[model samples]
Target: MRAIRITEDHAIDVIEARVPALKQGEILVRPRACGICGTDLHILHHGFPGTCYPVTPGHEFSGHVVAVGQGTKGVREGDFVAVDPNVVCGECRWCRAGRPNLCLHLSPIGVGRAGAAAEYVAVPARNAFAVNEKIGAGVAALIEPLACAIHAVETAGRLRDRRVLVLGGGTMGMLIALASRKMGAGEITLADPVATKRAIATRIGIDKAVDPSALGDELFDVVFEAAGAVPALKQALTCVDKTGTLVQVGVHDVDVTVPINPFNVYEQEITIVGSNSLADKFAAATELMPDLQKEAETLIGEPFNIWDFAAAVESMAAGHAIKTQLVFD
Candidate 1:
């Protein structure tokens, strides 16, 4: 089997390894579509915390089942499925509270366990959701990130008739915009410095897409900081209307901070929230995938084969790609 591995030296390379073994209640899948996420970059360049070295690093993936383990049910060999990489302990207080995203013993497949950037990946059968042929492989690969966007949308709450501002035009930002539009947000605006990204946003029916500098004094009912940059977070704060909500869905450096006026928050009754990874939104995202798939094509870059992982990363780092996906042979 061939897989992309992140070694202890923080280098990414295509390596040949034995296909992972499946345990009871798990299934072996041959990944057909895998997304190159920001987290993957973080892992490759900065040694993302909690990631074990020599791990295959792709979480956003979908494939067809090749082998099924004993005791697994509801999925069979040849079934096409999207995998939820988050593996919760199911015993933690947070898990008991229905907040598995915050489970104390969180072990996501790509981040902690072995992931799907390979010819074959073994995951618990329960983590895989069978999808209809109507969902394309590229679209099915988006189920993971879509779940995160869905969670962020749920955190934004009641977008009906409300103006929404998304402070990024990357894949995640676009997903947030798509979900917000579906949820009935009025006059959706996307802000990014990248001209390509902004153009794509407009082409996809977002009301407006502009450089951050052009974001005038007009305030929005909800502001989403999806750029994952400190400056973008600061800018997002200023775009929120007096009583509007600000949702931070982007992953930021742990040391990054932005100054906020305590008085302004108190006086305006403003609400600020942070959304992490998806909890149980996978099903909802899957259900919504067919509707979102058409517009999603504009957000993806030219697909690369798994062997060209380095080129994919370079494209993303050079800001020429919105989202890069690797296709299996």
Candidate 2:
């Protein structure tokens, strides 16, 4: 099998490797499509928390079941599925409390375990949710990020009839904005510096898309900082209306800090929240994919062959697409 591996020294290479062996409750999947996300970049260059170097970097993926191990009852070989990458210790307090994203022992695939960046990868069958093949592999692969976006919106509480602003026009931002619309946001504004991104947002049904500078003094009932950039976070904080909620949906540097006005937070009753990984929304995302399939398809760019992982990474870094993916031949 051919697999793309990133070393501790930040080296990436596609090398021939043995196919993964399935554990008793695991299933071996031949990945059809895998989306390269910001987490993959973190694992490749800087360091993301829980990343175990010398890892195969792809978590947002959909694949066909090639082998189902003993005790893996719900899924069967030959089924198409979208996987939830976060592997949690179900015995942990957070997990017991239904907040598995915060589990004490969370080892996500592509970060802490071998991921779907190869000819084959094995994951717990429970992580695999059956998806309609008609959605196409690229759209199925988006389920993971869509789940995260759902969780972010879920963190924002009520959105019906609320003015919403999403910072960024990347895949996460766009998905977050779309999810906000589904939740019945009265109006949705997506802000991105890139003109193309703004156009894409407009095409995808966002009420308004504009340059960050043009956001002016407008305030939103709910603000989501999905750009994962410090400047975007700062801008998001400023755009939240009094008594409104601000959801931090971006993955910022662990050591990064931004200035905030304590007086404003107190006097204006601003509620700031941090949304982590998908939590338990992966299944919900798969269920909702059919309705969103068309719009989700538009976000996927041309895929690079599995071996061209480096080129895909470069393209993603260059901001060449809303979503960059790797496809299996």
* Top candidate, metric lDDT: 2
**Candidate 1 Cα errors over 4 Å, as ranges:** none
Worst 10 contiguous positions by lDDT, candidate 2: 44-53
- Model 2 RMSD in Å is 0.7
Q: After superposition, how far is residue 273 of candidate 2 from its true place, in Å?
A: 0.3
Q: Please give, for residues 1-329, the per-residue lDDT of candidate 1 as tens digits.
A: 88888887877888889988888899999998899988988888877777888889889999999999999999999999999999888998999999989999988898898898889999999899998857678889998999999999999988999999999998899999999999999989999998989989998888999999998788999999998999899888887887899999998866777899888788878899999988889999989998988787777778899888888888877878678999999
Please give, for residues 1-84, the per-residue lDDT of candidate 2 as tens digits. Answer: 989999988899988999987788999999999999998888888888888888988999999999999899889889999999
Q: Give the whole-model CA lDDT for all candidates, comma-separated.
A: 0.89, 0.93
TM-score of 2: 0.99
**C-alpha-based local distance difference test score of model 1:** 0.89
Candidates' TM-scores? Answer: 0.98, 0.99
